[model samples]
Target chain A: MATPLLDKVEDEAAASPYITVTLRIRRFNPEISDEARWEDFSIEIDPKERVLDALHKIKWDVDGSLTFRRSCAHGICGSDAMRINGKNRLACKTLIKDITSFDRKTGATKPITVEAIKGLTVLKDLVVDMEPFFQAYRDVMPFLVTTGNEPTRERLQSAEDRERFDDTTKCILCAACTSSCPVFWNDGQYFGPAAIVNAHRFIFDSRDEAGEQRLEILNDKDGVWRCRTTFNCTDACPRGIEVTKAIQEVKRALITRRF
Target chain B: MSADTTATGSTAAISPVESVSVFDVDHPAPLIEPPRKRTAKTPKATRGNFEMAAWLFMRLSGVVLVVLVIGHLLIQLVLDGGVARIGFAFVAGRWASPWWQTWDLLMLWLAMLHGGNGMRTIINDYAERANTRLWLKGLLYTATVFTILLGTLVIFTFDPNIR
Candidate 1:
């Protein structure tokens, strides 16, 4: 009699409209312990809520200790890139409904594992130490160096000239492209795709005066020469950047100068 | 013989090894590809094998790159004189031995193949138009073959003393 009653209650709960998703987010508390582990979190989520929304809900409503970074809930900020369902993507753009498909009759929920992207030190949970990444960006001298005084008017250029390096300029300084690089993973000194892409932005710019110096910096064995062109950077780029093309342009520049 | 017409095009200038072509094999050479057929699709067998080989190469070369790159770091940075020891003499000394030469040759070949194969994967994935893919790969393969040949030539034809 008791078993039958329990089964009736379970059947009723299964047929309800409200569904709960379980996010097995990896947790790391460096000060507390040397070991890291996954903590299971079940939250009642609306079908339209994103994984980032759920993460915020968990952080604000449920647990204060669950760590991650997000800014400008839009994709432009590029502060919230993480591994969702074994792929690097922006939390803002990834919707829960797209990632999870439910069988209406069976009522089984597909669980997604969320973690930080690989090849960077995890500061806490989804947050990584981005200092080194920015250092590499700065090392490439990502600036427009003009020999003339400040332009009196907006720098006028032909449409084709701007379009030449337009693709490289869309980089949001996101680590998605850099972290996805295998060369960056093995050799930390290698100027990864993001830096090279930025370098290419100026290398192809018609108004820049430092092309020779920049080319010299990129000619080192650890510089542009080190890029293996695996194109993971291109595949992982959320902004749809032509990363390999930029690197090829740098290679061409170096070769042209060499001959 | 058919290469005589195509050789007149800009393709010859793009390749650093100026005289080499697939059709004319009067001398012993590495693999020489037949002149590309504009109307034909890449033969299914070669296409599939090349793609498969490229994919496997990323993983295999990635694993070896890790070891070679790490070993290179240990010797150059972590060892005795560190960055100061790296110079023309250091390279000259290292290349003096067959072991080091072979090591560098393998590194050069593997990295270039790994990189060139990686770029081929990207080209297949992205370059939408057939002509775009063909020309881009033509440029890529030309650059890759040139670098590989130049590197091999430099290694084999080392001149310790110069005027």
Candidate 2:
């Protein structure tokens, strides 16, 4: 019975198609060393699997010490944003085959490089201190503001008004857009793209009475004025939020005081 | 658990804790100071509408400068005999008219302010040190003011008959 079970497991392993891929990760263990270093791990995985799967495999089977942040693992939680192949992306949404370079003749694959997002303190391997990012978010007062008493039923809004800020509503609080910004990388004081994008979401909302207040906050020296319109935020946003365009809208609102 | 491990509590149900703390709770790790973090010394945002006005001035002055500059360029470099015709007398002839004086005056002020504001933005963006930004902006303002004043004086006091 034991032999049959062992034979069945071997047969399953042989039946599945797996390809060898190398993951080149920038590892930082403060306890071990003060400096970060690059480490490589080779794993057998399916090409269609997400990059998160490969990391999971390496951590579970190869090195239990490997660390990264992930939750939901479906791109909604926005916890696993990292630099993949020099671009900011959610690891859970990136496929191995999509990012890997394969040589057709030799059937060889180039290693996928992974690193922590820039513009934030890296706590450990692929884990960054999110407090700064969240601090910027909280500074913008990202919520509906009204002076009058609460509505007995519900606040009403038009379809067009809701659609006005539809794009920025998709933000998952991921730092992908903010970290990819060159300005933020150089100057941490700049409110960064994510903050401006969040401010835009409310500034254009028809029902939000405090648009002027948010605009004033963003009009500070380090606010929306710092954006150089590099469009890196737009490209880095996994949720397809037009991050730069939203920032422009906020700037316009500041100028005209009209949504 | 072994006797040695029990004595040290290293082999308790929980594994041995790393002896070193990766990060200190008192002093959190930050590659750079947060930009908007407030301290007792931090001043309020008293700079109301200055940046907004500057941004608007850049665009408005840019539009006006295009007309003044291109017209001036066309007259000086392309209208008559191009570069060769631009002599001291030619400048005096243009400055002789109040219309041309206003035009040239507008061009100098707009261009200087426009370019000066651009430089200010660059300093704010690139200069990492506070002292560096202050010194650079100081130099920029001094140079900009000197150029504007000198240009205005020359335009106003041009002597057509001075050989």
Which candidate should be chosen as best, given TM-score against the real structure?
A: 2
Model 1 segments more than 4 A misplaced:
A1-18, A101-107, B1-163
DockQ of every predicted complex: 0.01, 0.15
Query: What local lDDT does model 1 show for residue A207?
Result: 83
- Chain A alone, model 1, TM-score? 0.87
Error of 2 at A235 (Å): 0.9
Give the alpha carbon lDDT tens digit for every residue of A141-240 in model 2. 9999998888898789999999999999999987999999988886777878998888888988998988888988999887888888899999999999
What is the C-alpha local distance difference test score of each model?
A: 0.73, 0.83
- lDDT (10s digit) by residue, model 1, range A1-259: 4566887889986774445777777766454433456666666776576889878876765666678988898899899989888788888888877788666887877666889877677766788877667877887899988886898888888899889899998999878988887767654556688888999999888888888778777776456655667788888888999888888888777767755
Each prediction's number of clashing residue pairs: 0, 1
